[model samples]
Target: MTNSTWLKSADNRVKLLIFAFTILLLPFVALSFFTFPTTDDYCHTLTVNDMGYWAYQKHYWLTWSGRYIGTLISATQPLTYGSYFGYKVAPAILLLIYVHAFITFAKALSANKLPTWQTALLAFLMLFVFIAEMPSVAGYIYWYTGYYYTVADISTLYLLAYFFRHYPAITAQNIIVLSLGLILLIGMNEYTLVWLVILCGSLFFFKSIIDKKLHFKFLVLSLVALVFGVLSVTAPGNAARAESGLYPTPLKYNLLFSLKSSFTWEFHNLSKMAPALCVLTLVLIPIACILYTSRKPGEFGFFFVHPAFSLLVFAIALYLSYFPSYWSIAEPPNLRGQCVINFWTLIGWTFNVFVIIFWLLEKERIRPILSLGVLSWVVAFYFFSLYLSNFNYRSAWSDLLTGRAARYNKEMIARTELVLSTKEQQVTVPKLKNMPYTILNVTPDWDPAWASVEVNNGCAEWYFKKKFFYK
Candidate 1:
């Protein structure tokens, strides 16, 4: 690569990264976060006895460890969707975490071989791939419980990056911190717990096979974390919880049912969601090929083989993501679970299409046919984004603009006045349900139970606990 060629590649990556940052940031533009707790947000909060560290000692190690941070910080609900758009630590932390994951995956793919910008491009492509096919992208971001799980789940990517980036310069402190991070990530949720183990184990085994010399320290950490992760899943508390009629089906029957459900769900979802999937692939496939398909620049004629290899890895990843969902009956079969699984499925589907297109571009013998196929999809995406997808975005944005949001925000303040003034156990706060959300049911209402001093209201006192609110 000449100086000019390298510079051009670098420039293209920066442009693409900026584009992705814009896309990832786009949803916040429609600020309509509801004040009232919606669906599971109410239920999850009810499980937390109080906001003390003892809340961390409760059963369900996996769910507690996964949600501990978010549940703690989220003492107050969004109050309004607009709360998340600002520079506050609460709203932007997830974006920063995602950026870190982006950087990590980029390093894995390109390392020193590609420019920094290319890494950014890869990260954006992955996010775009997931967002385009997501069952409910808004739910993953705006739903408090949903976002908590998603954040912990995404920690897998950060951990992978930590291993890849820090393995070379591992200090004692680094090892400890990284190990702790791994523990949190592995115990985040069963879905992440199961697949993350496979990811680390596969990496460990693959390194042993390919590198001929493996790091004993890395292996030890991996194995220890793996054991602890599995233990967390099967903790005595979880077993007791299960026995208490949380899951109706027996263990053996649940396993078989899970596998069957996993397959049936994937195929059914893929068929239903094909149009959006096709649009994302059409736009992203060629771009990934053009930017840098093979990690090694000198690998000639491996185009067809490499895409297949990429496809296989993503396919396995997608398949394994569903394992935790099937293993137990605790997992929801709605958009929340689908959103998590769809993240990986969409990634696999994108690579499967990208590599095939990339291979055709390499073969002049069948260039026109492949080129036409790519062109057709690209055109399809163009129409889909402009006509179909934009309607969805606009509709979502418009829904939030209703007086209900401003009304709810005011009602919440007024209700707080009644409670704070009277110091009452219960107050009939003014009605404040959110406007309809298209992708997520952010259309929330207060659970009447939450009004109790023992229940949600105490947990919610954190919202007012802040100095900013009191001052």
Candidate 2:
């Protein structure tokens, strides 16, 4: 085929890939309609309603967690106003935001050489792998509390995109916007705070070295983010909560365990998902090559570091994310935390692979060997294997096709009705008969000894203004 014809064919194939990936994402979004509030949702609703928004924020800062933005979100959760529909639609909205941010970042990274639609196709592929490999779909995406982490995650992408689009000559407006964005990112959660500090610090260090001069803007941004991070970490609530026995591990043990478990979980998931990750890396190679070729000479100075240095930085950032959870909670990060880690893993790993490819391409001896036709077949085979092997997507489809999601929604509605209508202050509800994997089910069984039962019961009672229990 002629070069022009091949280029046109490649464009058409990318469009097709975009459509296919969109179709694959539909089940996850469709599952959102059946989502309901769970443990923390009820607790947050009751606390925020009782204390008022600002007071709730103060309460969390002084008594529970140092996540200032997180508390703000908790104070205004959709369920705070008894909007079940709002609750159900939140995950879908978050998913859309994530999609937009990823595409925007991709465009910026490629210096807008890639068409918007092609960037979107790239985003869809990454998001697909994220959903497929995430440790907890329901907790990380469906559950309101856990999914709030996505706000910071998405903001990070946008902030980086903004930086990439207007670096080294960032205007005053850009600085102000980026500073505010950094505060938002640092206050949402500790994991992202650490990641941001490291990211900005590393950029500041490397950019100075590459350009042979200081970059004051990055230094300013890093300082701003670090100040907020310090405020978050030093909040009285952190100490209070630590002593409250929620995290009973001693500091020594916590440190030791975190050191060991960080590497353990990282390697475990890396090994388990190697095949899928390899496929994703293969798909990203040509795209990365395109990005490398499109960049103006001497642009993105910090991005073209040696592969060994990039890998080391990636490993450090990844491990730091694990350390905060282990230190505070005396356990590995929960699935929600792992969700953030896994998302970053995919992103960072992809970038690291790109760095390697860029190094090879710069040498003029290496070129992408696979033809577009062959790559398309590989993409097709990937989705086929993904459909067959991805438990999260399979479970999502099962929940929808088997009517489990509908039944679960119906049952929750019935339970809510029972709570509202019963004249008696105390109400007993039946156990959930259909538990969909796509939705978080926080209803405790008959066993009161269950860890979350008391908290769930208390929140349910407060929210319903009645005594609530389940058989």
Candidate 3:
């Protein structure tokens, strides 16, 4: 086939893939409609309402977290204004934004050589892998309070896209835009701060070496990001929050624990088949196709680094994702934190695979091995495996099929109605009979009697203006 004809065929195939993935994702979006607020959602809404927006931001900065941008977003959750519909649709909205950012990054990486439809398919695949294999879809996707991490992840993608699209010729405009993006990213979450600094620092170091001259604009950008990162890590709320945790370890112990725990988590993800399948089918295949079709191999100068060095850089990035949680709290990150780690893992793995492929393409013997038939088989197997074992998709479908999500929504609504209508100062409600596996329910329950008295009562009392307990 001619090159243009092949390109047309490939674009058509990518469009089909995007459509299929979108259909598969619809159930997860549907489940979001049944989502209800829980745990920190209530506390944050109450605090924001009582304290006002600016005061709540100050309170969070001083006592809870230094995540200024994150806290700022959390304080304005739909629940704070009693918009249940807004709460229900927030995840869908965030998911759409995430997809857009991913597509932008993917297009930039491809240098716009691929069609928009092709980049979109790449985004869909990445999203599917993330939702399916991430440790906590509920915490990261459905929970409104956890959205700071989501927004941070999205911002990172956009910043990286901008960097990729405009590197080697950094303009004043680029510096200003990057500076603003870095400030927002660093303030959203410490994980993104550490990840971005390491990534940009490494790139700046390598690019300077390659060009045999210092890039002054990037140097300024890096310094700006570093200053913001320091501000975030040193926030007074970090210390206060650490002190308030139930178990506080010494700094030395926390560092050691973080090293061990981070390595263990990284090793676990590396060994998983699902992620490997995703790397091969979603990431490697498209990259190989783009490289093979390109007229000049030298256009990808960035991928010319030694594969071992690239792997080491990616390893450090992945490890640091786990470090902040352990260093601060002396425990593994919560489910929300795992989402960031998983994202880093996927990105690192994909990049490493790309480096290897780029290196292999230089060898005449290996060029023939990357055939269309082999890629087709890989794609077929990926879909088959995803259908059989993708945990997120299966869990979401189970919640919908068994009516668990509906029942959970019904129970939460009934409880809210009781809290609002009751004249008594204290109220007792029944424990939730159905909890969807696809949603995280951290609210206190009767089974754990203390949780009912402690967490459930406090937040419910403040938010509903009535004491709440579970029977």
Candidate 4:
């Protein structure tokens, strides 16, 4: 190829990267625009309405099931939601992570020293894969409830890539950064930190296996991961026992069900074909390289396939972690099944993301059709996931929201100038009673048996109690 031709190809690759970045942001705007104000959103709105900016700080008082960071944000910031916005720091964090993932994927493609066309293909595929199977976007981005998971997962991936790229230069200073990253992951949710540990271990294992000289580093990584994993899983220092009225055990059990639930959801997506294509690319690429090098035996060896092999190793690690049905030993499923599946899922997702890149970066004649097909499948999968999410919300919405009559009270509070003098009122509507949420105690009556109360602003306040509020 001539110098000018090479220059044009490089320019095209750069343009393609820019295009991918633009595409990534479009979904964020699109999803945020259409979602209705669900109950959790409304409840958050009510909190803002009642406490004003202080509601943000009060979020810190609320313990996150997995991570403590949200509480930290709420603690530091007087959580503010006006007529137009609720606490959006979580979503903003997600945006940053997605952007970072795209950039990293693109740079890796560019650096792999592949042909120009191959580079463009790789970049496009990465973004495509991310949107397809990552139900995080559908669940959290749409409802704003699951955004933290997206933020934490993408952030952990980005951080892992950064650490890996600079492994030799990692310093004591980097340890602090890694610590903060762990805290943020845990804050996003405990599962995230657990996943982070698994991923670090996976990466270390990959290096040791692939490099032929990194056994010590791999051992060290495994130990660090083991220690971090233990600390993360056990660190819920102040968890309270569930009240008799709640079914916490069933919910914990549901985490086990995640093995089935996640795979079922994933397989249902049309875009899952992308992973199959990735496996094909991984297989074909080595075959092609073998043929290319067979023409000149001195130019290459089986090790020319190291990147592909590395990918396979990583892919296996991911499969074991995320693909729920892969763990056959656990009967009917156990916490062991869900114990740290997110790690594998996230890593598996990352591998898929890169496979999409490889598809795009291949210099074959069918590139355009492959790219379009992959992109179309991903978008279709995203919409399907959204449809399923809405279906779930619809199924539960009436029971969880409309049945409560809490929206009416929330709307009333929205219009009132009532200084929430005291968070001192909580009403427990009888379970299975089918009664509308009582507007009782707007006039300040406290019957301890009939209510639970805390003093927030000053005036006695009453609210219904539930396992989870609507969002």
For candidate 4, the per-residue lDDT at 449 reads 19
RMSD of 3: 3.6
Task: Give the TM-score comparing model 1 with the true structure, all chains together.
Answer: 0.67
**TM-scores, in order shown?**
0.67, 0.91, 0.89, 0.52
- Against the hidden true structure, what lDDT does model 2 obtain? 0.77
Model 1 worst lDDT run, 10 consecutive residues: 462-471
Q: What lDDT does the true structure give each of the candidates?
A: 0.53, 0.77, 0.74, 0.42
TM-score for candidate 4, residues paired by index: 0.52
lDDT of 3 by residue, 67-118 (tens): 9898988887788777888768988888778878888888877778766666
Report clashes for each candidate as comma-separated counts.
2, 0, 0, 22
TM-score of 3: 0.89
- Give one digit per residue, the lDDT tens place, for model 2 in 1-471: 685465477567576766776777677788899987776678788888888988888888999889988787767778777698987898888887887888888877777777655676677777778888887888888877775577777887898889888874788789899889888878888778877888777777776777799988878987897889899999999888767866655762466787887778777877776777788777778787777777787675545777877888788988888777667666677777777777778878877887888888877769854335567677758778887778888888999899898898888898888888999998888777888876664334542211143354666676777876677
Q: Which digits, one per residue and each the tens of the lDDT, describe model 4 over residues 1-471? A: 584465356676577556655654543542332223322334444455566655544443343232355433332221223332333234444555565674564444233345544544444444444444343333444334344555555676566655644454556666666656665665555445445566567656666666676755445555665665564344443232122222234434345565665455434442444553454344334333323433333222222323455466544444334432322222222222232333345345445444444443443423322233345446446544543454222322332345333443244344232323323343322212232211112213432112232322222122232221111
- Alpha carbon deviation, residue 141, candidate 4 (Å): 2.2
TM-score: the better of candidates 2 and 3: 2
TM-score of 2: 0.91
- Predicted candidate 1 versus true structure: per-residue lDDT over 54-127, tens digit per residue: 45445334343333344443334343232332212443456556767766765653344455775675576566
